[model samples]
Target: MKKAAPVKESGLGMMPANSNSWNIETHEQFLLSELLPLVIGYAKGNRHPSSAAALASFITLSTVLQSEGFTRNSLIASIDASRMDIHNAPEVLQ
Candidate 1:
């Protein structure tokens, strides 16, 4: 996918239109560090009836959908990996 604009927070509850880079491993970091802040800025900028929660959720869900293939494959891979009986291994589980 082509990169989107980098989003940055302005001092006055405003943010730049777009920058977060991510492959698979760092996607959550990008969301929490970058996207969440951007959403917060928007909420701050327009407080009346703010839909920041919904907006963030939509963006997150959309991102997941776009990357579903990788996600599914990763899950399948884990499923096919060696299995261990961890039910009695509380110390290791903890």
Candidate 2:
């Protein structure tokens, strides 16, 4: 049998500076998912849009992402921005 090639570990030794790596609670993810649609849908509502729930969700997610030793603020910001992208996409709801 042929020997398997050695796997390289280059670039795997670096840790993110602000890592807050942690796992988000299931309840938090669930709440975020639920709040997302409502957030996008309420853009034109008579009642003003409140980001309390979404912000809380992002903060939780950010903590989890950081705990995992990943870039956190960017991820959270991307997620927030994606919400708007999702709303704008014609096929998003379909």
Candidate 3:
């Protein structure tokens, strides 16, 4: 059997140095397409399908929740920025 190539790095990064920068990269495809199969094939030593499926589901759900939280925070920050703009508007423009 041919050995499959190792998966590429996910390019995960720490927070941006610039406070105003938001450069998030997502890897749902990598998780579903690559990691999921690997886990199902080799997880728990016995490679039980039920065990693998359960673990994969948990991981996928956790990742999705984290992503949702990030999106929610971004929206809140945007709203705050809009409020600042309103407060800073010239009296004539108000």
Model 1, position 16: C-alpha lDDT score: 39
Residue lDDT tens for model 1, 1-94? 7754333332322423333332233487777788777777777777833476656666665555444444655444443442544344334231
* Best model number under lDDT: 3
Candidate 1 lDDT: 0.50
Could you tally the backbone clashes for each prediction? 5, 6, 0
Question: Which ranges in model 2 have alpha carbons more than 4 Å from their true place?
Answer: 1-50, 73-94
Alpha carbon deviation, residue 34, candidate 3 (Å): 1.2
After superposing candidate 1 on the true structure, give the runs of residues whose Cα lies further than 4 Å from its correct spot. Answer: 1-25, 48-94
Which residue pairs clash in candidate 3? Answer: none
TM per candidate: 0.31, 0.32, 0.27
Q: Rank the candidates by TM-score, best first.
A: 2, 1, 3
> What is each predicted model's overall lDDT from 0 to 1?
0.50, 0.52, 0.53
Tens-digit per-residue lDDT, 1-94, candidate 2? 6743322233323544443232234346654776676664564363555576556556766665565566756575556655775546445221
lDDT of 3 by residue, 1-94 (tens): 6743322333233333564233222555676788767777666567576676776666665555455454556445544655776557444223
